[model samples]
Target chain A: MLRRVRYELAGRVAFPLLNALSSWQRQLKRRGRKPRANPFGPPLDCVRKLRELMTAHYYVGRYAQGAVPVAWVTSGFPIEPLRALGFHIVYPENHSALCSAQHAAIDLLQAAEQEGFSGDLCSYARIDLGSALTGITPVGRLPRPDLLACCTNICRTVSYWYKNLASHFDVPVVMVDTPFVYGEAEPHHLSYIEEQLGELIEVAERIAGRRIDPERLERTMRAAWEGLVLWGECLQAGKAVPAPWTAIDGFFHMAPIVTLRGSEQCNSYYRMLRDELSDRVTRGIGGIKEERHRLLWDNLPIWHKLRKLSTLFAERGFNFVVATYTNAWAEAADLIDPAKPLESSAKAYTYVILNRDLEHRLASLKQLAQEYRADGAVLHSNRSCKPYSIGQVDLRSRLAQDLELRVLLLEADHSDPRLYTDEQIDNRIQAFLESFS
Target chain B: MSTATAIGVDVGSTTFKAVICDGTGRILDHLIEPTRPQMEQQAREGIALLVERLGCDPALPISATGYGRKRIPSARQLTEITCHALGAFHLTGRPGLLVDMGGQDTKVVRFGSRGEVLDFAMNDKCAAGTGRFLEVILHRLCVPLTSVAELASKAERPVTVSSTCTVFAESEVVSLVAQGEPVEGIVFGLHRALASRVAALVAPLAVKEPLLMSGGVALNQAMVRALEHALGNRIAVLPRPQLVGALGAALAVRNSQ
Candidate 1:
C-alpha cells in the first residue's frame, strides 16, 4: 500500500509536474534568447513533449520496484504481452544508449571492466551489468526485475546478457530465439516462436499471479501496431525535398516505440511528432538550414559523438535523410495484425532486419536510397555490433557499384570511442564529402 | 603545356615530400625527407626550400595532402586518398585500382576512367598492411629496406611469417631468428604477409584492368614484386612514385586557379 502511494505521489504526479514545469521554463528561455548563427533549423515543437514524456518515464522508474511488476527485456523482444499484464518494462539497451549520450557510460563501462568483463563485450551488456554491479547510473535508479525477457531476433548476445542479469538479480528469465531467415520464414519457424510466446505467457502469468486476459492483450497489440504506423509516417516524412527531421533526431525519437510501444501515450507522442514533421515539410523547413546533399546511413549511431557528427555533416551541407537502423523500427511492424495477436507477433518479430539475410538488407538500403534521392551513403562499420557490421564491406562495394553513390565505410565503435583515432576517421569523412563536391 | 608555377606539399606521417609543378602537372623541383617532430614548422621550411631551389616566388599557390595536410598552411588541403588518385591519373593517364602503401595507412583506390575516385578502401585502424609493417619487421631483422629486394631475390624457399599484426609479427620474427631461420627467407615471408593483407582489401574493389602502385613503399622492388605475385596482375609503378601525392596536391590548386 505504501509502495502504491509512493508511486502515485512521485512517479505519476510529482515527476510529470516537475518535467512540465522545466519544459515550460526551457520554452520561455528560448523565446527570450538572442538569435545566433546556427546551422540547424528551428527546434521541433514536439521536442518539449518528448522531454516531458521520457523524463516522467525514467523518473517514475525509481519508485517502481515494489509498486509494479517489472520485466527487463531486449529491444527486439515482443513486449505487448508484458504491457497487457501490467508489467513495467525496463529496456536496458535504451538506458545504456541514454547513458552513452549523457556522457556517463565510460564510468559504468570501466566499472564492468574492473569486474573482469571483456572490453570486447557489447557496451549495452557491459553498462547493464556495470550498473548492476556498481549501482551507478545517470538515470537516478533502475528497478530490479521480477522477470527478464530476451529475444535472439536482434543478436545472440542478449540471451547471455539477460542470463547474467538473472544471476545478478536472481529473477526468472524467458528467452525467445528466432531462427535467422534466409529468404522467407517457414511455417515451422513461426510456430516455434508462437510456442515460445505461449511458454512466456505461462511464466509471465505465474509471476503476476493472474490468468492472462485475451481482450487486454489485443488492445495492447492494437496500440503497438498504431504506434508503429505513426512512427513509420514520421520516418517517411524525410522523403520530402528538405527532410522534416534528420535521421539523428529519429534515433532519439525512436525511444518511445522501442520502450513504450503498447501504450496509448506512446502512440500519442508519435501522432504529435508526425503532424509536426509534415507541418515542417509543408513550410519547406529542413532539419539543417542547408540541405545540399542527402545521404543514407547504415548501422547503429555513434551515440557519444552524435552532436559532433550531426554538426559536422550539417556544416558540410550533408543531411542524413534515411538510416537502415532507424528504418529497422519503422519497417516490418506493418506485418502485425492485432486481431490475431500471438500469431502475428510471431511473424512480425521474426522478420527483423538483423534476423533477415543480407540480400533483404541490401534491397532495403537500395529502396531507401532511391526513395530519398540519396546522393551517397555512409556505413558505420561498428566494432561492437558484429551482426550489423559483418556484411558492410561487401555492402559498401555493392552500393557504390550498383547505385553509383559515393559510399564510405567508416571504422568506429558505436559506444566505445577508444577503438578509432579521430584524425583518421575525420580525414575519410572530409574526403567522402569532397568527392560529392 | 602550362608553365611550372605551383607548389604541392605532402606532409606524410613518416616522410614528407614537396614538389613544384607546372599548371599541366609536371614536377620541376622537389624535396623529400623524414618527417620531423615539429610538423608545421618542418612543412613550412620544406616548402621554402623547394621554392628556393627553383627560385620561385614565395607567394606561389600551395596545395597540401597527407595526414598532416590540415596542420600545414596551404591554399587548399585534400586527403592523401584523393591526392593519390589525381596524382596517379596524371602520371599513368589511365584509371584502375591504385594501391598506395604509405608509412601508416594503405589505400586501395579505384579511379574512374576520367580520374574521379570511383571508390576506395583503407586498411582498418591497424598498421599490419602498411609500409610501417615491413619497416618494423625489417628493423627487427636488422634489414634495411634497400636490401629487401636483394635478400628476397636470393631466397630459394621463402619462410612463412603468419602473424598479420605488426607487433605480433615483430615478436615472431625475433623467435624465428633465434630458431635459426634464414634471414632472406624471413624478409621474403614478411613482404608476402603484407602483400596478402593488402590483397584482401583490393579483392572486393573489382576494378577494371591497368593496376597501378604508388607511395614511398613502391620504391621497394621486393614489396612491389610480392604485391604483383599476390594480386596476380602486372602492376605498373608510377613515375617518381613517392611524389604522386605531392604532385596531385600541386595540381589541385593550379587547376582550381
Candidate 2:
C-alpha cells in the first residue's frame, strides 16, 4: 500500500515538476538561440506544446509500472478500452519511430539482425526486438508491460512481433485478429472483431484487477473521435494553395494522435494545431516561401532522412502538401462513433489503409492528388513495407495515364537509413523535380 | 559555320563527353574520352581542351551532367535524365519516348508535348542491362565492345544468357565457352538479354513513333536491333548519340544565360 502511495505521488507531483523544469530549460535555450533561416514559412508555434505533452507522457511513464496497469500495444490496436481501464498504453511503433528520428536505432537494428532477425523484416519489429533484448531506448526508460496487445489491422508482422515480446516479458498477450478488408467490412467481420474486443476488455480488466466503467470508455472514445476530427481539419488546411505546413511537419506533429488519441489532452493539442494551421492558411503563408509545385507522397516517410529530403525539395521550390500515410489517421475517423464504440472501433481499425487492397490505395492516391491540387507524386517504394511498396510500379503508370501527373518511384526505406543510398536517391529526386521545372 | 556559345560536359561512369554548342543549339565541337579516376582534374582538362579546340573563351557558360557531374565546376548541373530528355527532344524535334542506356543505369524517359519530361523509370538499383554489365562480361569473354555487333551478326541462332547479374553472367559466358558454345551466339544472347530488360522499363509508357535512342550503348548495332525486336518499335538513333547528355547540358547553360 505504501509502495502504491509512493508511485502515485511520484507520477502526480515529482514527474510533473521535473517535466515542467525540463521544459522551462528547453524554452530558455530556444529563446536564447537565433532562429535558423527557413526558406519555408515560420515553424509551427505549437511544437513547444507538443514537446511538453510528449515529455510529460514519458516522464509519467517512468513511474507508471507500479502506479497503473501498463500495456504495450500496436499502433492500430483498439486502445480506448485499455485507456478506460486505467492502462498506461505504450506504442512500440511510435518508440521505434522516435529511435529512427534520433538516429539511434541502427545499432539496435544490427543487434536484432545479429540475433537472426533478417534485414528484410520491418525495421520497427527489428528495433523493438533489439530494445527488448538490450533495454536501450531514448525515452530514458520504458515501463515494463503488464499486458501485450497485438492487432493484425496494420500488418500481419506485428502479431508475430508482439508474440516475441510476450515471450520475452512473460506477459499475457491479447491478440485481436482483424481480417484484411478488401472493399468493405462484412457484417460477420465487424461482429467478429467486436467479440474479440469484448474479450480484450475482459483480459485487460483482469490484468488491471478492476472492472472498466462504461462511462469512462465512452468518454475515451469521444476524446479519440474529437482528436481525429481535429487532426482531419489540420490536414484539410493543406488544401489551401501554398499549404501552411509541409508533409514533414505533418510527420512529426502526428505523434499525439498516434500515442495519446484517447486522452482529452490529445484532442486539445490537435485543436491548437488546427487553429494555428487555419491562421496560416488565412494569412496566405506557404510551407515553403516559393511553392512552385505541390506533390503527394506515398508510403512511409524516410524518418531518418526527413530533414535532408525536406530541404532538398524546398530548395527546388517543391513541397509535398499531402501524404497518403499522414491522411490515414483522418480517413477512417468518419467511421468512429462514441455511442457505438465497440462496433465502430472494430470497423475503423479493420479498414485502415494498410489492411485494404491496392485498388483502394490507388483510388485514395488519385483523390488526394485531385483534392490537394498536386501536380506530381513521389512514391517511396519502401523496402520495409511490402504491402505499401508493392503494385507501386503499376500505380505509377496508371497515375500518369489517367491523371497526367508526373510520378517518381523512389526506392528507399522508412526507418532504416542503411537501405537508402545518398547519391542514387539524389539523382532520382533531382531528375523528378527537374521534370516539373 | 556557327561558333561556340556555351560548353556542356558529362562525366559519366565509363566515359566523359563534352559538347560546344552554338546559339542555334548546333554542336560546333565535341570530345569523348574514357573517364579517369581524378574526375575534377580530368573534367577541367577536358573542358579546357574543348575551349582550345573551338577557340572559345574559358569564361563561356558551362553545364555538367551524368554521375560525376557534381565534381565538375559549372554554371549549372543537371541530372542525366533531364539532359537526356532535352538532348533527345533537341535532336528529334519531337517529344517522344527516349531510351538512354548508360554505364551505370538504363532510363526510359517519356516526354510531354512541349519536350519537358512527363515521367521516367530506370533499372532499379541494379547494373543489369547497363553499359557496365556489357563491358564487364565482354571483358571476361575477351570480346571488344566495338567488335560485338559484327560478331553477333554472324550467329545463326542466338543462345540464351538468363543471368542478369554481371558477375553471374560472366561465369555463364565462361561456362558456355567451355561447353564449345559459339561466341557469336553468346554475343547475340547477351544483347538480347539487355534488350529485353530495357524493353520492360519501356513497356508501361505510351510509345509515340520515331522512338528515340541515346547514350553510348546506342552505338552497339546488334543491341539496337535486338532492342527494336524486343520493343517492337523502330529506334531512331540521334546523331552523335554518345554526346547527347553533354549537348543538353551545354544547351541548358546557353538557355540559362
Docking class of 2: medium
Chain B alone, TM-score, model 1: 0.97
- For model 1, residues B1-257, the per-residue Cα lDDT tens digits are 34568888998999999999976777888999998888899888988887777777888888899988878865588888888988998887888789999999999888866667878888888899999998998888888888889999999877899997899999999999999999998998888889999999989885666889999999999999999989988899998899999998888887688
- List native contact recovery per candidate, as a fraction of 1: 0.62, 0.81
Note each model's CA RMSD in angstroms: 1.8, 2.3
lDDT of 2 by residue, A1-437 (tens): 66567667766788778878887887788996888876788888998888878877876777788778999999888899999998989998989988999999898899899989999999999999998899999998899999999899878888788888999999999999988888887999999999999999999989999998989999999999888889999999999999999988999889999999889889989999999999999999999989999999999899999999999999878999999999988898999999999989999999899899888989999999999999999999998888789899889988888998989899988888898888888999999988877
Model-by-model lDDT, in order?
Answer: 0.89, 0.89
Q: Each prediction's interface RMSD?
A: 1.1, 1.0
User: Top DockQ: which candidate number?
Assistant: 2
Docking class of 1: medium
lDDT at residue B197 of model 2 (Cα atoms): 94
Model 1 C-alpha lDDT versus the unseen true structure:
0.89
DockQ each candidate and list the results. Answer: 0.69, 0.75
